[model samples]
Target: MKDRVTTPLGAVTLLLLLVAVGLGLSSPLDVNQGSLVRLMFVHVPTAWVSYLAYGGTGLFGLLYLMTRKRRWDRLAMASGELGVLFTVATIVGGMLWAKPTWGTYWVWDARLTTTALSLVVYGGYLLIRAMIDDPERRARVSAVVGIVGTLYIPINYMAVEWWRGVHQTQTLKLLGKVRFDAAPVYGWVLLAATIAFTLLYLYLLRVRGILAARDEAREERELMNDLQGDVSGLTPHIAGQGAQRGGAQHG
Candidate 1:
């Protein structure tokens, strides 16, 4: 099948880069953080993407359990992989931005720690999927892990406010004098970045899904070939036995 997602993905990426560059160049620097505020363009989007990917993994996993469909399992696995990638990005970006602001690259800060732990947990989930040879068992086991892992997302997100942490409180809020209210430009750029990252996730998921389908098809073909060979071998053995029996009957 022709890939229709790639072209739109490229377009979205180009637009994302353009908007990010525009924000860096034209938007006003934070009076407090100065140039360091530029990291927001990269850091925030990575965090957003991680959240989206992991959440999707959980959602698809739930669907797999309900319907017992291999397609849903493939989707859950694909989203989980993307979640790991973006989670690492979020951590790295956080470390880079943290050094200047927090006076340290690594900290046991609640939000950071929980976020890291979440990555490990999800990584373990992926590892479990790899170790299992039975497809049904793998899908069932991984789906449970995927669903449970989603709990960490909300916990990490709220860790900053729930427990006093070195990490700053969220800048964007939905109600009551949003923090980004003053910086309309930053808000718009952030929105664009969120959309771009979401599109990127969808594109990657589609690619991974295609790979999974191909792998399953190859395995099926190999199994069929093996069965054909076994049948051919059995046919010659049966014919030899029949000829011996006929010779005995003629005697």
Candidate 2:
């Protein structure tokens, strides 16, 4: 398949850079936090995109099981992997912002704990796929796990909300009254990030689907070739049945 990342990734990156340039030329620098706050350009948006990725994965997983389509399975797999990556970016970005704000790198808060669990679960999912040798069995097992594992997302959100911590839930609600002081730039950054992440996820899914279909097709071809190449054992039982029928006809 043609490269998905080069086109989409390049476009999003160009857009991000152009937006940054515009912000630089026009907007005033944040007063209190200074440059560190700029990390929000990537940080906050990645958090929202990560959640979106997981939700999309869960939805696709359920759809795959219902339909038994390989494309859906591939999408769920790709989304799960991308979501895990975004999860890491979220944690790391949180730490970057948190260190200056919270005076610590690590915390035992609900948000961090639940996010950690979510990451581990998806990581285990990837591990499960890696360990399995049979492709069909792997798809079935992974699909079920992906579908069942979706429950964690809501729990994760609620955990962050319910538990008091230095951490704050991400605010992607851009259209409502501006939530943050840097709403204009921050919100635009998030929207761009969302579009970029979605494109990236989709590209990966399409590639994975094509690759999986090719692999399955290759396997089937090999099985057929092996059967055809086998001389004496081509149809041992079938040959026996034919012999019996011929004898009955003769008698």
Candidate 3:
């Protein structure tokens, strides 16, 4: 753990997080939402990371299907795990932000609903892996599910615009045309926050992938050990049966 944190990538991630926190703290209050606007610093970045992580899950899953490699499956699993985590964080942060803004901690608005649905979908992806014993079959099924689950990401992102729900439309739009509604300072702080969160996600993904690989290795070793133990126990029984048959023949 200490070795991981001391690595170059980890050091960079830590530095960026510190910078984002400083910028978010010093950022001016929103003209409307006041202090509540600060929540955007954490909320928006977490949402972005969730989207990124889920997207990676789908992409890596596809690669696994094409290549049939354990590494790809491991990466896909890691991405899915991180996706679920960030999705939960995003929901919690949003709920905190919403209480003051909308007077409620929960809502069935399109964006919120879709976001919740995506969380469930990925959660199921992890569940599927746990239920299946065969690694190859598990990888195949999980890859397909991961690919299908990613469709929710676009739907969730566009839900506010498509349904015109209580949730606000995209504050920063880059497709077709680039537009930022808030002050320039907000954008800068948000950019910093986004970068920091992305780095954090990458760091977590690498660590998780390594752990998954180790787990697979350990499980494989245990399985081999069990098979060898069964064979060794059967060998003595077979030998005794053969000796008894020989003795009966002699008598």
Candidate 4:
């Protein structure tokens, strides 16, 4: 069947660009944060996307363990990579916003520190998976890590409130709770950004999953060929031994 999902990936890319322009260039400047508020369009979405990616990774990892299917493992792997990408973007954008707002790029603030630690943990997950050669073993170990690593998500979200920090409390809420308080335009822009980032993540996930499956298939083919070659090499010796035994029996 023709892949419908990947076909729209390019369109999603274009849409994301439009959303970025609208959020970063057209959105009105904040009275307090001024132009620095523009960074929110990038920062907030990336942070949320990273959360989504990690969540999906954990979900797929669990699915793989239950089903023992390589496709589920591949999906988990793809999501993990996307998670790492967006996590890095979130950190970089946060640091950019911090330098101006907090007067320093690096700080021991709970939110920032927890986010950094979360990045390290996810990065370690990727590193360990790369070091292992066996696909099944790699998936098993990585799934365990993926599930455990997600514990950081809630901690990261609550860090600003749990401990004293300059980081702002969670602004977005459910059931019309306005905690972060911004202009109507900002809210609209945030909604648009969230949708755009989600589409981008799905598109990337589809592409990554395809590549991973192809790579796995190629590796399997190569392994099968190697085994066949070894069996072929042993065939002549076995045939000769059988022929000698036949002649000895006849004599």
Candidate 5:
């Protein structure tokens, strides 16, 4: 199948650009936060996409184990790595916003702690893969980590409610509801940014999967060459044995 970026990602890129332009012009000049709140368009959507990428990794990891297909494994691996990158982006961006709004760059708040722990977990996952030379073992360990690491996502989301924390209550949520100080145009802008970042995430995953597949195919070809060489060496000895058998039969 043709990759999504070669086709659908074009639509996403175009649409997101138009929405971003609209958001910039429509945002009201807030009395308290001023124009800085416009950063919400990018920040909130990036946070959502980070969760999406990791969720995809976990789902595909399960599918890979069930079907025993290397393609699914590749998808999972690519998503997991990309998820880590995006998760880091979300934390950094949150800190940037928090410094101005909350008056501090760092916090021991539940939400922040959970996200930091998530980073450490994934970091260890990556480090373990690097330490191991064998391919099969690496996949096995990563699959386990991807599967179990899912618990942290919810913790990150509910950290404010679940504990007395520095993080604010979720603004965009089902129960508590959201109250945005921006125009309806800004809402569309947020929707556009979410879709755009998500497309970018998958695009990166597909690119990484392509490189990994090439590396795997190259290794397989090398193994085939070694096997053929061994077979070539044994062929001469086998023919000599056949000749001796023929001589015994003639006698």
Candidate 6:
């Protein structure tokens, strides 16, 4: 694992994380949230990674369906797993931040509700994969599910705007009119954190993809070995029966 962490990509990801942490620590506190604003450094970036991971899952799932390749399926599965993990992280971080801000641990806000739905959707996707035994069928069915589940992303993003719930509207907008509510330094720190988290997601995705491929390959090998063993065990019994039949016929 030292070797893995020492690779160029991993090294860069680690470096970025360190820089983000340093910037976040040094950044001025929010006037409204005070030091609690630091939580945004973690919460926003994790939320971003969750979105990225699910998007990757859908993209790779589409590729798998189109090409019928195990590699694509593996990548889709890896992305789904990471997406679920990061979604959970996002929720937990949000809850931690919300408890103090909202005086409640949970709420039925549109954004929060939609985010929860997204978690369920991808969680179900992983569960479906576990239930299926046939690799080909599993890949096909899960690919469709992965692709469809991505529909939640847009809805989740727009939930605050559409429903006008307690959840705040988008703070950082990429397209059209650029909007950032926080101070410039805060935005800079957030940008750094986002870059770090994105890199971390990519690094984790690559690791997870490799592990998934190895796991599938290992399972296939074990299945083939079991079949070969069964055949070998039956061969002597069949031969013995054949000899007995020959003897009876001679008698």
- Candidate topping lDDT: 3
- Cα-based lDDT for every prediction: 0.86, 0.74, 0.92, 0.85, 0.76, 0.90
Per-prediction TM-score to the true structure, in the order listed: 0.91, 0.74, 0.94, 0.91, 0.81, 0.93
lDDT of 1 by residue, 85-124 (tens): 9999999998999998889999998989988997898899
* TM-score comparison, 2 vs 4, better candidate: 4
Give the alpha carbon lDDT tens digit for every residue of 22-90 in model 5: 765586766777777777766777778778877877777788778877887788778878878988888
* Candidate 6 wrong stretches, greater than 4 Å: 1-6
Model 4: lowest-lDDT 10 consecutive positions: 173-182
Worst lDDT run of 10 residues, candidate 3, spans: 1-10
* Candidate 4 lDDT tens digits, 110-153: 98888888778888989989999998899999998899888888
Model 5 Cα RMSD, Å? 3.6
Clashing pairs in 6: none
- Which lDDT value does model 6 have at 225? 100
Instruction: Provide the global lDDT of candidate 1 against the true structure.
Output: 0.86
True lDDT of residue 64, candidate 1: 97
User: On a 0 to 100 scale, what is the lDDT of residue 174 in model 5?
Assistant: 42
Count of backbone clashes, every candidate in sequence: 0, 0, 0, 0, 0, 0
Candidate 1, after superposition: displacement of residue 46 in Å?
1.0
Residue 162: error of model 6 in Å? 0.8
Error of 1 at 89 (Å): 0.1
Model 3: residues with Cα > 4 Å off, grouped in runs: 1-6
Determine the backbone clash count of candidate 6: 0
